[model samples]
Target: MDTSTMIFIAVGLIAVIAGLYIYFYNKDKKTLPEAPAAPGSQELAHSKQLRLQAYERLVILAERIALPNLISRSNEPGLDKRSMQQLLTQTIRQEFDYNLSQQIYVSNEAWEAIRNLKEQNIHIINQIASILPEDISGVELNKKVIEFIMNQPQGSMHTMVQEALSYEARKLMA
Candidate 1:
């Protein structure tokens, strides 16, 4: 065979090899295993249980951090206004940090509401403390905090967060 004819034959053979490789590559993909099926009912139930527990913890956290409850829990006979303020603020931050992970299982809206409530409560505590005299007694600080919460037109942050948590939990149950 002449050089041109041999070259043409070699080119044809290369094209055939390329075509076979392309065909087999796609054929192998078709024989591969499919993705796993969706999770079973038991798995779903477990997830729901975890979500419910998270909501429960969040509700309890909200109640615990409520101004009245916090004041009742942290009040000390000899603590001055600055000390009381620090106690309350620290307690709120600790409670919030403890429950921070629970946010993953809750709805975004519910989580945001809980966060907002925490911030608002901290703001209220700091605002009241700032307005009071440094040497004022803890009892007086507590009274002022309670009064400020009571005067809020929409009620306290804790109540609102608790309500939001409850609503989310109910929706999940249904």
Candidate 2:
């Protein structure tokens, strides 16, 4: 080749070699292997703190939902059928409403199941009331309510309550 031709070929060879080096050097980057996570840093610690706050909120929610406030607000020693039904249903709704803030931290499954369980418990209380004689004593009525709760279907209420507790626990973990 002539002198100019030789210089041109040299430049072309240099460009090709540089391109190859860059291509091979960066090939691994296209499929980066996930590096194992190291120990927690400041940011990680902050994230953990946030998670702990979420857990606390969830626990509060669970408590509010499940607490009885010593005795039900609508307690009536001689509640008639309509009054009793309203009281039982209102108690269920009040419990759920009081825990309304907890939905943010808990899973959809947990919240939905808990809501369903509360409804079912109210329904069960109503069912028990339906079979009672008009002359049933207050003591007997209270016993019947307790018995209905004891015989709730397949530990359904227990499962929902447990799930709520689990959600609170999971929130605390990073």
Candidate 3:
């Protein structure tokens, strides 16, 4: 082709390329504003923090309701086996109830684990107490619960619940 024709073609190609680049650049700029994203990021950070706090609370709940810990904490000097059993179960229920609001912030699986642990601890206490004589002292009830926990081959459910909560919290951090 002649020089003029060649120059015209080159200029057209350059103009097309430049126009396309500008179109895309302006398109991206038209998306969400920088100021809006700041608020959104802050909200996301707050949400993550709330979730972490929930996990922490649930971990504490698990520890509080753990059979051995509950028995010791609720142990009385003169109460009978039935009374001790009632106290142990009541304390667990209270702990579980206090933290029930945290379920919204945590995963369903984690919340379920906490619930299961609570139910299991209460059930175990009732079962153990039923096996003992009605006149046995609270101390004996506490001892039996401890022995039951010690004899568990796979370890306590509370440990697993804590681990699950910790794992979920760590995932949030990452």
Highest TM-score: give the candidate number: 3
Q: What are the root-mean-square deviations of the candidates from the true structure over C-alphas? A: 25.9, 27.1, 25.8
TM-score winner between candidates 1 and 2: 1
lDDT of 1 by residue, 61-152 (tens): 98998889999999898988888888999999999999999989987767776786677678767766776677789889899778655655
Residue 123 of model 3: what lDDT? 68
TM-score of each: 0.75, 0.52, 0.77
**Model 2 over residues 46-152: C-alpha lDDT tens digits?**
75566556556544444443423212544568766556666657766776787666667554645554665465456555555666776665445556666444443
Mind giving the per-residue lDDT tens digits that candidate 3 earns over 1-174? 234643443454345334434543554465433323355587888988999999999999999998888877887899988888889999999999899899999978678778877876776677667667888899998987787667555566687668767877886786
Instruction: Mark the regions of model 2 whose C-alpha exceeds 4 Å error after superposition.
Output: 1-75, 135-139, 151-156
Top-lDDT structure, candidate number: 3
Clashes of each: 0, 0, 0
Residue 157, candidate 2: alpha-carbon lDDT: 42
Ten-residue region with minimum lDDT total, candidate 2: 62-71
Which pairs clash in model 3? none
